[model samples]
Target: MRKITAGFFHSVDGVVESPNLWQFDAFDDELGALLGETMSKIDTVLLGRVGFEEWAGYWPNAEADQDFAQFINNMPKYVASRTRSQADLSIWQNSTLIEGDVIEFARELKAREGGEIAVMGGISLARQLFFAGLLEELTLITHPVVAGKGKRMFEATDPVTRLELKRSSTTSKGNVVSVYGLKPE
Candidate 1:
């Protein structure tokens, strides 16, 4: 079965929104290599409506020399959105719209033969997947700075989820990349 791995850029305070504002200075070649490695392992991308719209607007026009841009443009993308129609998703090449139960779709995707499915962004979608127990692994690239106000990666909730730390490494630029495997219930 293909593993669903969700990767997010987070702040010290657990903020996951707008990492570009604080993550630039902390981004180094080491971190870039790590991100590239992660991208190489995933042939499919899972995104939410917001992430799809934002990326579709820019990534398609991005320079061909940019490795990440090229990867995103070429990979098969599946966007989970109840509001977006097929026409909306077709704007991005190699993109598909997922309208029904996301968990069921994820299950079917995992059952298929593939390299890996990477959830690039979309905090709400990631949270939903985490709660549904569909995510097999999660990689949090935590920057050292603390963003005082932003959408947190994890919210206050009733039942807590447990994760086992698989590996962790720090880049020279102070980005702590931590990989976690979802613990069995």
Candidate 2:
């Protein structure tokens, strides 16, 4: 069985949106290596509708020679959208639309034989998977900045979900990368 990992570039205040506003200064070779290593393990990407549309528009036109761009462009992408049809998803190469119950679909995907399935920066999809108990791991590359106000990674809600910190490290540029495993219910 494969694991579902949610990776995010976050601010010290837990903001996950618009990393470009705060992430540039803390992007070092060490962080690059770590992100590259993580990407190497992912064979499938799970994205929400908004993220799918945004990435599809940008990545295809991006430099194909770049390793990250090539990896993302070629990877099998599953867009979890209630509205997007197969024809709509086919606009992007190797892209598929996931309709109906997302939780069940995610579980089935995890049961398949493959490398890790990654959920990156899709807050809606990530929240659904996290709350559904479908996500196995969460990796946050936390930068040394307070976003003040933005879409936070985790919002306060009902019963809190507990995560066991598996590993943590600080980059040369003061970015903290932490990996956490979901605690068993």
Candidate 3:
């Protein structure tokens, strides 16, 4: 079975939104290596509607040497969106709008042969996949800063989900890189 993983650049205060706004100062070689390692294993990319729209606008036109530009731009992207149709995804190349149940589509995708399905930065989509038991791994690079305000990864009302820490390390810049697997029910 193909492994499904979601990675987030999170803050100490739990904010996962727009890490670029607050995370660049703390970015270092260690973080870059960590991200490269993660990208090495992933072939498919999954995105939520918001993330899809946001990324489609920028990554396509990004300079050739820009980080992740070539990889993300050329790789097949499956976007999970309830409101978007197939016609709407033409703005970006190699993007397919998932039809019907997102969870079911993911399951089918997992069953097929692939390298890895990566959930890039879709908070809502990642939460849904993680809670639905579709995501096999969750990796977080927690920077040593408190973003005063932004959308968080989890809500208080969300059902409790347990994770087993597969591995962890602190970067030179005080960023904590942690990899977790869902605890067996």
Candidate 4:
């Protein structure tokens, strides 16, 4: 079975939205290497509606030399959007509109033979998969700064998701890198 993984750029105060606004200054060589390694193993991408719209607008036109352009552009992208039609997804190459339940699609995809599947930039979708027990692992590259206000990854009413820390490390610039495995309930 293929592993479903998601990597989030997090803050000390638990913010997850718009990491580029706060995380650029903190990005270091080690972080670059880590991200490169993660991208290397992922052959499929899973995204939510918002992420699909946002990325589809830019990534396709991104320069070939851009770090992630080639990989993300060419990967098989499965988008979960209740509102988007096949025509909307046709704007980007290799993008497919998920026809039914996202969780069920993920379950079937994981059981299929493939390389790693990475959930890209969809906090809502990632949360759903995480709570539904479809996500096998999560990597958090936590920066030292506290984002004053923004949407967070977890909320009060969310189900308690247990994560077993598989490995952790701190970068020279104070970013905390941690990989966690989902613990079955």
Candidate 5:
């Protein structure tokens, strides 16, 4: 089965949400490249409801922006939500709401014809996979910034688990790219 790739940008202090969020625009080139590679590997993009709405709003019209105008415009997306009633999505050729059980569904998806299935945001969804030993690898890009407060990353009740750093590198713009795979027991 294909592995699950969790990719997110964070700060030096491990803050995924930074104060100067405008810099995200500049990261589009990097984002596009990364996402391009991701889509080349996996066809499915797992997203939470909020993130789903945010992405759907931006990506469909990314053509207006030079960076992700081409890359983000394409690629199938799936949203994990309980409240969402509509499944019709214009951004992706194959977009749908994750119905029924997600863990088993995710696994079934990875087993489909693809290279990697990416999961973004929906920390609750990620935590579910992590605790169930379903997540395979984590790709984190740490930017050089910090935000004192925002949405919290981890829940208080989550347990500590070990992951092995498989590869790491620093981008020209000083972004830290770290890839961690689940440690073998």
Candidate 6:
């Protein structure tokens, strides 16, 4: 079975919005190292149209030009969309747009051969997957500072769903990385 691995960056108080106001002079090698190690373990990359567009541009250029970006470029990516949205699909050499019944498509994708499929949170879509009981493992990488006003990761979009904690830890950057797996049957 294919599992979902999420790497989200949030605040101490649980927030996953963007951080554009921080002042940093140099890259935190420790944090980057930790993130790199974690990312190296995953294979598949799944994202919504918004998140796909956001990452397809940068990550493909940052990593070894063939590491993370190459993985994103060559590996399978399932993007959830309703209105035929294709934002720079060129970056993803092997990509497919998800329409119609997403759960079925996602399940089919999971059944195929692969290591771990990561679901990059776009908030709305993550809630959809959470409600559908399709998510296996969730990894939330939380940060230290809180954004008073920004987008939230998930807000109970479904009627009712439960997730049991699996593992969690604090990163060197004072960030908390929480891992959650859906309640087993």
Q: Quote each prediction's TM-score.
A: 0.95, 0.94, 0.96, 0.95, 0.82, 0.79
Instruction: Say which prediction, candidate 2 or candidate 5, comes out ahead on lDDT.
Output: 2
Sorted by TM-score (best first), the order is 3, 4, 1, 2, 5, 6
Error of 4 at 112 (Å): 1.1
lDDT of 3 by residue, 66-134 (tens): 769988988899999888998899999999998889999999999999899999859999999999999
List residue ranges in candidate 4 displaced over 4 A: none
**Model 2 over residues 23-78: C-alpha lDDT tens digits?**
76888999888878988899999999988888888788786548877898899998
- In model 6, state the lDDT of residue 64: 60
Can you write out model 6's per-residue Cα lDDT over 1-185, one digit (the tens) per residue? 87766666665556665644431322255557766786776676677877877776777567564555655666677788776555546556666787678778778877988787777736666766666777776677666665576677666454555678898766555666677878776
Pairs that collide, model 6: 10-143
How many pairs collide in each candidate, listed in order?
Answer: 0, 0, 0, 0, 0, 1
lDDT of each: 0.86, 0.86, 0.91, 0.90, 0.68, 0.67
Superposition error at 124 for model 2 (Å): 1.3
lDDT of 4 at 11: 96
Model 5 CA lDDT for position 157: 77
Between which residue pairs do clashes occur in model 1? none
User: Residue 24: error of model 2 in Å?
Assistant: 2.6
Q: What lDDT score is found at residue 179 in candidate 1?
A: 91
lDDT of 5: 0.68
Tens-digit lDDT track for model 4 on 1-185? Answer: 99999989999998998897788689888998998989889989999999999999999998754878888889999999999998999999999988899999999999898899999979999999988888888888899898888889889998766789989999999999988888655
Backbone clashes counted, model 2: 0
